[model samples]
Target: MVFSTEAVMRGRGDILHGRPALVIGFGKLGSSIARLLQAKGVQVTVFDIDPVRRTQALSPGLHRRPRPRDRPDRRQPGALRDRRDSLRGEDFSHLRNGAYVATVTSSEDELDLAELPDVYTRTIVGDHVTRYRTTGHCFYLANDGNAVNFIHGASAGPFIFLIQAEILAAIRMLTREDLAPGIHEVPAPDREAIAATWLSYFNR
Candidate 1:
């Protein structure tokens, strides 16, 4: 969420404030990104293959829409758009000239570079980070279609460490051979203990 928000906001002026933003997935990370974008006043649209996830994305101010078609609504021609699919040039024809595209999926195939026309400009946003532009459109292939938060220099952050600790605890439990073979809940007491420890360290 932080990385996507930063990518859209940094050096782009206030583009996110009123622009239309699309998030391609609706998993934990994608949902968080959508919420953050919405909080910043971006009109967020989310697409996911999972029906449950798609339903979850229909929040108060966010939109859940189907993929774009060759013939889009002519009434809103200038609206910004985003997509997540194996790139086809025709898929981009519906967007307005200045629209921005960012892909947060795990496959570079999501936005094939070969599909881009030769008249585009490429800019390096960071080490191994690149964005392409043509005419009025900007494209950010977030971590080359991998999770944006896992970019080379990015950290998982402090909160993630807490989750990691919980996972480690779960692993330890599995090793004890005292449990069933199926999924099991992590006890609330264990989570609370970890949270208390984390809070104490954080407050320090």
Candidate 2:
């Protein structure tokens, strides 16, 4: 697993030290990113479509920020809580101001990012599900994200994959070639030999 705990922490530290970061889709990667940011004295907020997971991973006073209910002067009537809960969507005004958003879910729905209101300057990241590549199959990288195809693995054994280009303009930018075919293949070696044994469990 290239996305190990240490690697995830290092990536989180890079963003935390650079700018204020927000993590969406709090699965393994998002959760780890948030915890690492918190450990390094960075403010982190988590949002997810799954309310149950959100409530579990992000509770009041769990981080350096304050929850709506935790503010002493801002108390809404009990009836308003139900109304507020019923209308559940992010107020994207702040996100529009350039909050970096990262997602770790398998969702390929473009609406999750494209529909954000006024979010013209936010950095967004999607996981492996966004682009899955296979051997001999051509692919095109988008302006937003790259394709990650599994090339070197088999149905029963471990292996690497290759990256191909579909669109010439995008391909030229990535490979610096004309409107020609491009192939990206990985070597047939174990790159994880130096990693701790715990990482192998993720592959399983």
Candidate 3:
């Protein structure tokens, strides 16, 4: 349900700003979400049970997060402590005190946090109910607690694209093409007008 805004708002106050963060999944949505958070200047620490996925994020420019499986001393600079297995355990102790706790993984071997009723899960469900609800299909749980986890889903593609477009559009408007080569540039007037348009879309 397009919850990037709510997710950021709920967790923004707690973001570490410059400190490292651990993102524990590499699925489509998980990866895209991680990229967005990283762009905001948070040091991202990613982990995936799949060796290939983990290795991909580890590439030189990708700044892959170090896993405990990797040699201790040889671990990457942004490597977090060994908390990869625990879903709701001390494995995340390092991030407990950090600004943000972005748990995007749902290992088959491990329990699924989505089935549980937590703050993060509730937030996601609430976003869905708010944005896309039908009289007969409207089924949502009340907000009871904080969403500690955000499981990935196939629908992430469209949502990710929406967020990326908005962010890139903003980046383009703020900085010229020469200043940010990879970023898309939207004319200043167009940007303001489009922003208002998007706001109206959501307001409806």
lDDT scores in order: 0.60, 0.32, 0.41
The ten-residue window of minimal lDDT in model 2 covers 74-83
lDDT of 2 by residue, 122-163 (tens): 322332222212332211112232111122121312221111
Segments of candidate 2 deviating more than 4 angstroms: 1-15, 49-51, 58-96, 105-204
lDDT of 1: 0.60
Over the stretch 1-204, how does candidate 3's per-residue lDDT look in tens digits? 114333443443423345555555666655765576577676666667677877777652345645554221212222222234434422222223212222232333332334433222123433312111222221122111122233223244434545666677776667655555554555667657665676677556
lDDT of 1 by residue, 85-107 (tens): 53455545445444445444454
Q: Which stretches of candidate 3 lie above 4 Å from their native place?
A: 1-16, 69-86, 94-99, 103-204
Give the least accurate 10-residue stretch of model 3, judged by summed lDDT: 136-145
In candidate 1, the residue pairs with backbone N, CA or C atoms under 3 Å apart (3 or more residues apart, or in different chains) clash, namely none
Give the winner by TM-score.
1
Under the 3 Å rule for N, CA and C atoms, how many clashes does model 1 have? 0
